[model samples]
Target: MIPSLRLLYWRPSAAALVRTRALLPMAEFYNHETGDGAFRLIQKSDYARALQGARVGLCLSDHEGPMRASVEYQLLDLPVVTTEAQGGRIEMMDPAHCRVVPADPRAVADAVQELAAEEIPAGAVRASVLSRLAAHRAALPGLIRPHLQAAFDDASAGVTLDDIGKVDLWRTRDAEVIRREVDAMPV
Candidate 1:
């Protein structure tokens, strides 16, 4: 943890670990337990308020599914210090406002400090996410058009594998599988 920084750990489980293990000593060293200094324990529900007050958001989990919290933080225009383990968060994050580091506290703290020192515009961060989402939405039809066309043509012709072009063979197999599954279902 950075000496000048105040970190709020929002996960109850992480607080429990700090209380039960060798981490407690480290927390004490940082004056985390006294609630008077560099570290504090907070509830997840307070995230919106916390992000508003905080200079950086930290996502340190080594394993995660979607990490919506990190995205929310970015949407709120806060810079994020995330572990490399972040899966979905990495995709939407702008490098100027986000740093992907190892799961070490020192690295996280350093990233936080670095980001804090920079002049990242909150509107830019929010715009990056919005633009990415809009691009994805715009591309949705392109992604599904071929499949929809294949389905429509297949329904009309009662498609056979031989009738499908090489590029669309996967769709032909998928249609066959669906047909087999439907035919096997009871009336």
Candidate 2:
């Protein structure tokens, strides 16, 4: 697919938004029809469809595990611009095609533009990402080391597996704080 759009950034958070805004002049993504000029919120159902015209994948999350969207972008032959992230997403990237950047907005924006403009071969992107991802997949088990599973196992020694699964795995800090941060950015 031709990269008609400049950037694709799927995971959004308050800190992510601060950086995302710097690249807004170039990216094209859709969310919940926020009626804002800088963005349109995307739905999970149409994520792959939304990635079609994107020139580069912007992954700036501070998530502690492997990011799914960054892998998806590479598989689709799109170059990536990622931060010095907590997760091992960087390991899946070949520096020749994808960039490992700092959290700074200006730096991320510059790297995204550079990758977007380059005419790197699609096959090369996919090949490199695949090789790295394969190697990382093998190495991952050693690094994570039964982290959450071990905790759950210890906590539920006599409890059923099904019982352990039911829990408040996800929650937010404060809705108003998030809304305020989002409002701070220009539409």
Candidate 3:
């Protein structure tokens, strides 16, 4: 049986068209275009409902920050086929539930086929996201504490309000200054 696929396009950009064209020959293409301008926005509930019968979610973007849609796909119990350059998504997904492939369309097609043949439990996929979220929450304070301390120390230092007024905020807030401050913090 042919596996069901759901392609979620947030904006009607050239990128979306490229992805759709790449996958069209591999499977039957369906167009559900709505809305106007570049955006084809859908409600979260509607998106989730649309994913109900999908066997896999495809994220074919060349780059992504966190790949929020892929995470949503996992939450809705759909396996994800994403690109490796998808930022935090690589770290968020478990290998069992997510396939990180190259940007090549063939690679994406192969991953989809592989995932379609296997049975991935929905609860396990959702649990992977929850576990990552819990770990991130637990570690957030530690990651942020040093920066907060550095900012506090800077505020209390010999620099007076008058001196602060004279100083260029942009230059003072450069990456090198921040890096030096972070590096100086005690482990």
Model 2 scores a C-alpha lDDT of 0.67
> Which has the greatest TM-score?
3
Question: Where does candidate 2 stray beyond 4 Å?
Answer: 1-29, 34-45, 138-187
lDDT of 3 by residue, 14-102 (tens): 77677766856455233344443234556767777666778788877777777787788778777788887835777778898789899
lDDT of 1 by residue, 1-187 (tens): 6544434444356557556445534332222443564346554555465556667777878788667767787778888889998356777788988999998878888898999899986588888878876776666545444554666754434343334444464555567776785467543
List the candidates' TM-scores in order.
0.58, 0.55, 0.67
lDDT of every predicted structure (CA atoms)? 0.66, 0.67, 0.69
Can you give the lDDT of residue 135 in candidate 1? 74
Alpha carbon lDDT at 27, candidate 1: 32
Candidate closest to the true structure, highest lDDT? 3
Q: Please, what are the lDDT tens digits per residue for candidate 2 over residues 57-154? A: 87887765778778888988889888888876887888888888888877887898899889897588889888886776665444333433454555
User: Which regions of candidate 3 are displaced past 4 Å?
Assistant: 1-5, 14-39, 152-187
Comparison by lDDT, 1 against 3, better one: 3
The predicted structure with the larger TM-score, 1 or 3, is 3
RMSD of each: 11.2, 10.2, 8.0
Sliding window of 10 residues with minimal summed lDDT for model 3: 28-37
